[model samples]
Target chain A: MMDSPPGVADLLGVLAYAELTAFLRFAEDATRHAPSLTDRAALGGLAAAEYAHFQLLRDRISSLGVDPEEAMTPFAGPLDEWHAQTAPGDWLETLMKAYVGTGIALDFYREAATRVDDETRDLVEEVLADEGRSQFAVERVSVAIKEDPRQSGRLALWARRLVGEALSQGQHVALARPELATLLVPAGDDITRMFARLTEAHGRRMAALGLPSRP
Target chain B: MMDSPPGVADLLGVLAYAELTAFLRFAEDATRHAPSLTDRAALGGLAAAEYAHFQLLRDRISSLGVDPEEAMTPFAGPLDEWHAQTAPGDWLETLMKAYVGTGIALDFYREAATRVDDETRDLVEEVLADEGRSQFAVERVSVAIKEDPRQSGRLALWARRLVGEALSQGQHVALARPELATLLVPAGDDITRMFARLTEAHGRRMAALGLPSRP
Candidate 1:
């Protein structure tokens, strides 16, 4: 055993917990918004994908000789608080949150995966792969906003709040787990530069959703 | 092209919705009761399995040229009501609900799978195949009851109530969709006999959990 890296377990644990929580949140939103059985099934399918990702990360953590629970426990507070602070008010808001929030998180994971061991990096890249289900959210949200242009302002505000809260939690996690942060940014890399890239990507996703880039 | 069978869509719809709701309910229970990270991860994996089953059925429904939403509409009321009526109160109750409820639902789907076409039947059998995740429930519940034998009486009562409500919903489903019932039982096959077999299996499962068979 090469002693695993300083933040391998922590990163895996955080990602695993994130997927599990995303599964629950998506399941909840499906129940709340699935206007038809088809929509519900689609949302259910998306949630299942999240759970599958959670399993992969969890197994990877276990294989590293760390208790998956112990690994995930440290990140639960920040993740749960992020969800609490950014809870969606309705169906469209839920979709926006899932789309914007997932996009940013996956981007962060992709960036962080570059700094870890090949095995861990491969696992992270695999989990970060998009399943195209978010297309459903994008199409639906775009159509809904187009139909009622007035709703755009409110949804835009909601998306901004989601991004703000997510970034706050990301910073909180980075501060609480210095080793994990170091793994994410590496020894010579700039955390501030990485944050800028994440934010720029977030803005592009917002533009795709027809929402304004700034909060 | 031979038109789809009278009840094939209905049957697929019912199973599809059942899996979706089961996914949601399981996700909810996992959030509520998982005492440890491992337990929570186990529940998440189980929920993922249900969602996988949901996708299989939903895709089948689409292949038959019927809109999956319209196909799933008729059974939503009964399934939702069954869940509402049997909502779990705590961690133990949540585990009991997941174990007993999922066991019975799978049994019903298994029996009904017999009456459908080979392709559909195969899908049903595939989904019904146990991934051994329920073992997590059985072990936990059995150990808990063994530790505090006095709690057995109340938990047993809860199990009976679950069965009763499930049966009631089963009856409601049968009455509302005669085509579905006809497909489930076929000619000369006794529905009562099917119910007996289901209950017999349910009893065996209860016994496996150290609960009295009579309950």
Candidate 2:
């Protein structure tokens, strides 16, 4: 296959694991009743969609000719704790996780996708289309919060934590994949600007989602 | 608007509630990490996906002109208890829940889709596509188990509990949604056959996984 920088594989591995875990969790946890059968069905259906997207990532990894299992073996622990440590405090908080985390991850992946060749880039685009609903899911939660002013402040805080925890674990991910980040460096410049751009973009996402921009 | 027979809404409500609760619990519990950053990301991603699916269902309900909040209110309890009673012992057991329980739910949803209206039928079909990577995750753990014969029996027993707990919850769903079950009666058939078919399907799934078919 095509070649990229040293840690691009690690980035892909992390992305692949994210999709897999999300697929499993969505299938397992989305069982409770809603007011309507249609609502219930929709919930279950969306959960299933995530699973398919996850499979795409898995396929992408194996197609790259590296064993996904080996790539996924190393980064599993810290990522999991960040999630547990920042588990949603309630239903609304859960929605915020999707609204905030998936949205942010999508942004990051879009940037990472630009650094790769046609094959990997296409995989990234395919996932982007697949995640269309994820963005809508986030938007819907924002609408709900908008409808009820009481919900705004609470969800904002939740969104902030989602950002903070993400950035924290993200530090670990960066340290682990320095070469992946190196792909972002200009021909003669240092890597500082790459992260600065990522942070600036994250700030835009927060603003778009109606949260305050990070200092 | 098309209407479900008496109590069908309640049954659907319970199922929806269960979905929501399952989303919450799995999201919370799966994040319990054991030092692997890869594991952490995998688990977190899974939780985020579940939350997204939960939003889909919630939005679908609102689209139907029903308030999702009101619809989801009824299913928060008994379903919660069922999950509590059936909680997995560890990561492997958790994966088994994905394999055994979700595998069966997908089957039931597939069969049930035939009885619903076209829109609902399409939704079910869409959801079925999402079961994509779950089997692979489960398969990964299964491969690990067979590598060590001693691990087999533990997983085997775990499989039994997963199936058992599911059967118990499935009954609650069936009893609660007698309308849907009645709708499945072929307009003149014995209901027992329907239950038998469900059980039989569950049996095949278990056997396929090398987990003993339920007694």
Using DockQ as the measure, which candidate wins?
Answer: 1
Per-residue lDDT of model 1, residues B1-215, tens digit only: 15656789998998888888988888887887788878877877788888888889889998998888888889899999999998888878888888898899888888877777888888988887764667788788898998999978888889888888888888888888988888888689866677788888989988888887564
lDDT of 1 by residue, A92-161 (tens): 8888887887788789788877788888888887876764767788788999999999989998888888
Which residues of candidate 1, in runs, are more than 4 Å off?
A1-3, A188-190, B1-4, B188-190
**lDDT by residue for model 2 over B86-192, one digit each (tens)?**
67777766666656656665776666666766655665566677776465556767677678757767776776666566667656655765665675566788666
Which DockQ-derived CAPRI band holds candidate 2? incorrect
True contacts kept of 2: 0.05
Clashing pairs in 1: none
- Interface RMSD (C-alpha) of each candidate? 1.1, 7.1
List candidate 2 stretches off by more than 4 Å: A21-51, A130-161, B1-81, B91-181, B184-215
TM-score of model 2 (CA atoms): 0.66
lDDT score, candidate 1: 0.83
Model 1 clash count equals 0
CAPRI-wise, candidate 1 is: medium
Query: What is the C-alpha interface RMSD of model 2?
Result: 7.1
